[model samples]
Target: MTNLGTSLWLQPPRNSPIWQQLATTIQGLKPIFSDSENFEPHITLTSNISVNTQGQVDFVLDRAVAAAKCVPQGFQIHLSSVKYGSRFFKKVYLQVEPTPELLSLARICREDFVYMPEAMSQARNYQAMSAEERQKIDTQVGQRAAEWTRNEYDPHVSLVYSDLYPVEDADRRTIETRLEDTFGSGYDESGLGWKNGRFALVRCEGPVDEWEVLGVRDF
Candidate 1:
């Protein structure tokens, strides 16, 4: 847990056509960017779950099982757009539509796993502050763990991690264009814009290539 900690992910079924196309797209993009890493495509449900002990690992796995059971099996997630961002993990990804099912699953995952001590400490301090003082602090901080816990459930299936590349806005635009041309603009016309998939608990620490799946369950 010293690194970025663990995450729960919704991974496309490996045998599906959508998975094949996404894997191909990710591999094809690697040669175009310098020092890019290959990674399994997944939409993070909830992240930054610190698991520093065997007991915590077991707790996370058990929670993942309980969360998966709360949702539908073989759920479908549709793509909204091919986008890029400055964050290393979100350099290039397919933005997923914020469907009710997706949002519900994210909430469930967060309720189960994201118990950061920073959030707890901040909550106690905020309770002692006046309304005006709390608002001032919130304005200064912009977004904190509590805000993220409530509303920041952005789902994306990353296709490339090009943090080492000198990627410009134009490069991102070009990549987006090429991806849309290849994958059909996130509308499922090319049969690659959606996934019937399962959820997994992943050890997403250190290097992206080193991330490991601890468990996977249908829905």
Candidate 2:
């Protein structure tokens, strides 16, 4: 909750019948990742702006609203596969098939959105990084951001939103097994569907309860 940045997200309909079920199911799957608040199911468009404070986040949002209006937003998302990393605290999520409109909108948003950088130091705060390596990061963050753009962007809707990190191997396996049990039932068919219309902004670092819906738009 300490690091501050802004991001754009496309939220599925809150009223959708499967919405509650999905959140509840994820929490029940494993206790290590459970939360009381129901996090909004979203596909991230742009995130981790280099702003330092909420005031700056507000400034970015003001510019983002108009650009968001210019782009269309009614693409039907197809969740086709389950994906997870062996790394600790990495989330389990459903892979989204990138459609023409979705791809186009991703490109458009990157071009239109403003990310005014006050600082980029927080990104390098890791134990393994040497001082020289961290200094190198100062030059290479733009390259990293590029991964989230164009053909490199891997679009997926996260099923868990926990900040738990450096998990042990046995714990990781237990969580993975629970996820397999919960969502591995239908690999052959498109798993579940939810109508998407709106996009919102929130602090990506905090708990679900700490997240605030900064702005919303419908297309």
Candidate 3:
């Protein structure tokens, strides 16, 4: 597999009650699926950051630091619903409310990191594309990233990454029921929310299990 570059993630403070609850829930969910991987729960702020080279890595690190400095305090992140998707990473997860603060932070990270010169150059199939095709793909990439940053950013904390288990409506309901039994219903009622958190620059290369954290910044 090709390296998918880096991503900016918003992670709940490890010491927070919400974090502990999420950690426990993620662990508990593993047995329900035949093939599932354990992963740290987080909300992706921005993805597809170009960190193919040492210089690109350093550049992204600097941008992350700068972005972190923009928000001196932690912001609230509320869990709105328990949902499931076909995507491996989002197979089953908690949907986060699109709070203004969260959106603002996402925008900042996107502006700082998404359109780096290295982004287009490090495309997965860059070597196979003609110059014109590369330019077209580059434009598409930029436009998609911008659109996602501005209006389509869906924040969620993933609970499982299993290709074998497809979460249907019934399965989603069961999962929701289990979560409610474990952590109560709403974010307010169950303390399923974070008041503040940190940012991590993760190298999302290879398989999901192999993803590595390059650096972190606390707000």
Candidate 4:
């Protein structure tokens, strides 16, 4: 989009079967929200890094690659639960169970891309926390994340996009109903399984086609 430094990543390779199942669920549920793009399995760590110019965007990615090279390339995390993120925006999402690796990586990215209050305000709708608030959440999340070793992770994928105003309960119910009808029925689950791998830096904002990869980072 218009914002700089916006990118998507997956920490580890997800099981094809589990991922497929999730994808199917997302596809079936897409109509409930604004159907823009097809769903792909990913855990979006950070989004919308503001860079006024293309050069700035490239610089950030280059630095991110260098910074990420120091860490190993893979880590295991559990997909724990499907929860509704109502605070930031009304949306249903799969929550990744907090892991030390995930938290560490997230913190590093946040620190590296720390922005001014104006920029921070722009990300409010995306993440409920402001830069200051995120620090606190990150600290607590980090502690809990560190304790996740053998435990199964709770990663909840969103099924619906909650809007500022939920027009009709029936409309919401209908969407949920459609998802259940499509996914609840026994469909071939292709991409649903255990996932562990590295995070790739797909693209940084520039010209849509002329984007740069920030390089993949291992957890």
* Candidate 2 lDDT by residue in tens digits, 70-147: 545535667765566533223666777877656656655554453213223355444467878755754454444444
- List the candidates ranked by TM-score, beginning with the highest: 3, 1, 2, 4
Query: Per-candidate RMSD vs. true structure?
Result: 6.5, 9.3, 6.0, 9.9
Query: Higher lDDT: candidate 1 or 4?
Result: 1
Per-residue lDDT over 100-181 for candidate 3, one digit per residue giving the tens place of the 0 to 100 score: 6777678667755776345654777776879898778667666655677667788899998777556766766777777887
Decide which is better by TM-score, 1 or 3: 3
Worst 10 residues of 3 by lDDT: 112-121
Over the full model, what C-alpha lDDT does candidate 2 score relative to the true structure? 0.58
Best by lDDT: 3
User: 20, model 1: CA deviation in Å?
Assistant: 0.8
The C-alpha lDDT values of all candidates are 0.69, 0.58, 0.75, 0.51
lDDT of 4 by residue, 1-219 (tens): 243455535544444555666667767765655522343556655555555555665565556555555556535556643455443222666556666665665555554554332344555553766778777655654544344323423334444533434335765667556544644532223222254544555554544346555555443
TM-score (C-alpha) between model 1 and the true structure:
0.71
Model 4 segments beyond 4 Å from truth? 1-5, 11-15, 33-37, 50-74, 87-90, 113-156, 162-193, 202-219
What lDDT does candidate 1 reach at residue 49?
73
Clash count of each predicted structure: 0, 0, 0, 31
